[model samples]
Target: MPPRWPRTPDRNDPAFRRLEDFINFALHAAIYLAVNSGLWFFQLLNHPWDNLSIVSGVWLLGLVSHGCYVFILADYRRIEAAAQGNWQQELATELEEDATVTPDEAPSSPEQP
Candidate 1:
């Protein structure tokens, strides 16, 4: 089954972003495997293509790079921590603004004429 997010999915969500990146990499790898396998199978039958190895090698490199990025380089924890920090800062700012509002300066209901 496809994954579903508990809340609205946004690019700013670290978990969602990480999941999306991984899913994309998985799709890429799957396509690479399907295509390269088919190419190899056909090459074994007729041996017509001369640059098949070069093509597969380059594609494998790309797949490896993608895997490295998704599995090793991407840091979800840091992203989540930074997002949390931003949220905390925003909440603190809002609380400070609310605390600074005096009763006289606060918005009141419209006075009836």
Candidate 2:
């Protein structure tokens, strides 16, 4: 079966969250707009002749476009990749070194538990 939710960036990672807040914001905004879509149709009950649906319809279209960028084209890759640039491989190597380092020899950090 397919996943119910879209493939999203890790929220716990500050690099992915704040650096690419637009992706997360767009995703949630789309959901809110989608849920409210029916309200636009219901507006027909009061103003059958006015039909101002183009407002919501155009916003929904923009949401679909943003969704395509986030889920299909994978915009998160560009954000994270730009942060590491050429140091990705070097960072990986450093991570491997940290794995083998004993607690006593490990580097100190205020956040390390």
Best candidate, lDDT-wise? 1
Instruction: Evaluate model 1: give its lDDT.
Output: 0.87
TM-score (C-alpha) between model 2 and the true structure = 0.40
2-97 per-residue lDDT for model 1 (tens digits) = 767899987767889998998899999999999999999999898789999999999999999999999999977656656777756666776898
In angstroms, the error of model 1 at 49 is 0.7
Per-candidate local distance difference test: 0.87, 0.61
List residue ranges in candidate 2 displaced over 4 A: 1-35, 41-44, 85-113
Give me the displacement of residue 90 in model 1, in angstroms.
15
- TM-score for every candidate vs. truth? 0.68, 0.40
Error of 2 at 61 (Å): 1.0
Colliding pairs, model 1? none
- Give the Cα error of residue 96 in candidate 1, in Å: 28
User: Which tens-of-lDDT digit does each residue in 4-44 have in candidate 2?
Assistant: 33456575443555446565766669676665566655775
| Pairs of colliding residues, candidate 2 | none
Candidate 1 local lDDT, residue 83: 70
